[model samples]
Target: NCIIAASDYYLDDDGKKAADLYQKACEFGHPDGCKWAGWLYMTGFGVDSDYVRAIKFYDVACKADDLEACVNIGFMFENGAGVDQSYSAARDIYHLACERGALQGCNNLGYFYQEGRGVEKDIRKAKSLYEKSCNDEAVWGCNNLGGLYYKGLGVERDIQKMLHYNKMACDRDLTIGCDALGAIYLHGRGVPIDYQRALEYFQKSCSNNSMLGCSFLATMYASGQGVTKNLKKGLKLLTRACEHGSNLGCNLLKVHLANEKAQ
Candidate 1:
């Protein structure tokens, strides 16, 4: 019997056992196994990074009609992770996936149109695609649409609309949206600066796994902005962020340490 081991290892905590087991299950013909194995290989969470192998597994999974795998393949092509970077190729794959009703694919396809990547720049098209994804409850799509409204990209700048979509995504627990909104509130962008609100949003974002949020929250604590100065807490938060791969956190920690040494 093929081990239904994918979900178990997909958390992928301690080590290579996760990636290895996923691959083993994949070899035994588990379609989900192929996708998970490909994901681990691409990210190198518990195994050596292997873009070629990642693509191969994704291709197999995609051929099995796994739309998510198809989207991953498109992403790999878009970034040239293992193969030659080809925006056209990425666009084609994304188009195929989007046509098949993959919301992520539609969002990425919107990005391509917005950025003029391998396709003619078409802000209206981008807006349409983003709206399609967002209406379908893709949080990233809502975030992107918010950015367009905020920047007036192919639409008149509309702060209310921007906040509406941003809050929509943040309410859904998307860390990026939370962090962005937190920064906006902290800086008074399109609204009065509200350090208390910033603290709440940053705290929410950080607790939900946003490294940047942790870094900003650490800054707030260290600077005593609407909160008591707590160097110990700040340092601990920064260290946590760094361990989780936030370069901003690492850099800030180094800066603070250097300042203390200078003192």
Candidate 2:
């Protein structure tokens, strides 16, 4: 398909060629082509960022029953990107998408319920929605459900359940879940501490781009908790984590730098 080829070209950094192909596909009334074109415009990949034009193409794809396009429209409304900020509108769209079996929409709606953003704050409803999303295989939904279980919000406190859900999410390759498992093992929350297990979980999370995991692993390395002490390796990991926006990593790196200077 021209759209698929366009995507390949885009991934290869031939934005202009991709845009031309996408435009051709869009002219053929391919909904996905229109969506891709909109994305390119929205991100300024192959063209200038034009929120207005992006909205137009997205609207077209959404009208064609593209679920992702509807979600994108909801995001645009929620963030006031090329449109008026209207949480109410976003909520309506998400509700529609959820009704159509979009798990991401269910997860987002659960968040709104939890935070009282567009809907009334209802922890019970949030829990139920999260359960539905998790059942639908949304990893973030499982993570959120684990958090609720851990905090005993709208459900009885159940550490076992929390661990179960978090582990399930981690097994599915969610970095946040891996980070949670690492923390649990590191601190002996519900079981005896196992520094080696904690280190492995943190390593998995860090490999998946979790800055918090990198920070924790760096600390362990620095102190030789589970691995051989290597201050140089620790400092490098800490620096990487900080560069990736971990405030804890940044703070720890600063302390380490100051201590090294003093020595």
Candidate 3:
């Protein structure tokens, strides 16, 4: 009912109708509907922008034990949306949601500990939380753990472990993981130096929409490192990387384009 109406409004771009249905659904005790209504109000998607209303609906959803709602509330607090900026409050709510088994909440708490945002800087605690989230199959958690291992933060420098974690993250279809793996291969950091493997990983990451990966792939094609030199293919990838808003990519593309024109 509410869901159908919401979908209809979404398809029609009818914000007013969506807001009304969501409001009614929220009053009927539908937590998900309340959550959607909160987002709509927060972003002014259907109704006039009202952070206070968003906060109220989020509070209601959180009281209903919605972990996502709790996490959203934490974000609002962290960003000072509709409430006084308070990292402590954000941390507390993030902790609550993490305890409730929200992997994103765990990741956020880990980030706070990692950067000493709302808590004492504790690399070890951050690593533990990242590992916990990773074990729970969180892709970002695996990426963070891999980064920590790579940088030897609160853990021994273990290139193999870093590669392992990045692979885990990549298996979950995370572009970051694919890009990291490509870098490791390109630089011979963890695994044996293999241009072919680097190209493969880079292509995977690029296909996943990573501009960095696209740029790297362009270089690989330009230099004939793994694949045969194809200036045209390289140019296309470089152009795409630039269009994706990578300044380095733009520079690289401009240089190559000038060189091609000179030739």
> For each candidate, what TM-score against the reference?
0.91, 0.88, 0.81
Q: Write the per-residue lDDT of candidate 3 for residues 56-139, one digit (tens) a residue.
A: 999999999988888889989999999998999999999999998988889889989999989999999999889888954467
Error of 1 at 252 (Å): 2.8
Candidate topping TM-score? 1
Tell me the tens digit of each residue's lDDT in model 2 across 29-85.
898888888788778896888888887888888788877777778878888888999
Candidate structures ordered by TM-score, highest first? 1, 2, 3
| Residues 27-81 of candidate 1: C-alpha lDDT, one tens digit per residue | 8777777888898899997788999999999998899888899999999999999
Pairs that clash in candidate 3: none
Least accurate stretch of 10 residues (summed lDDT) in model 2?
132-141
Model 1 alpha-carbon drift over 4 Å, by segment: 1-3, 12-15, 135-137, 258-263
Error of 2 at 78 (Å): 2.4
Please give the distance, in angstroms, between residue 3's alpha carbon in candidate 2 and its true position after superposition. Answer: 2.0
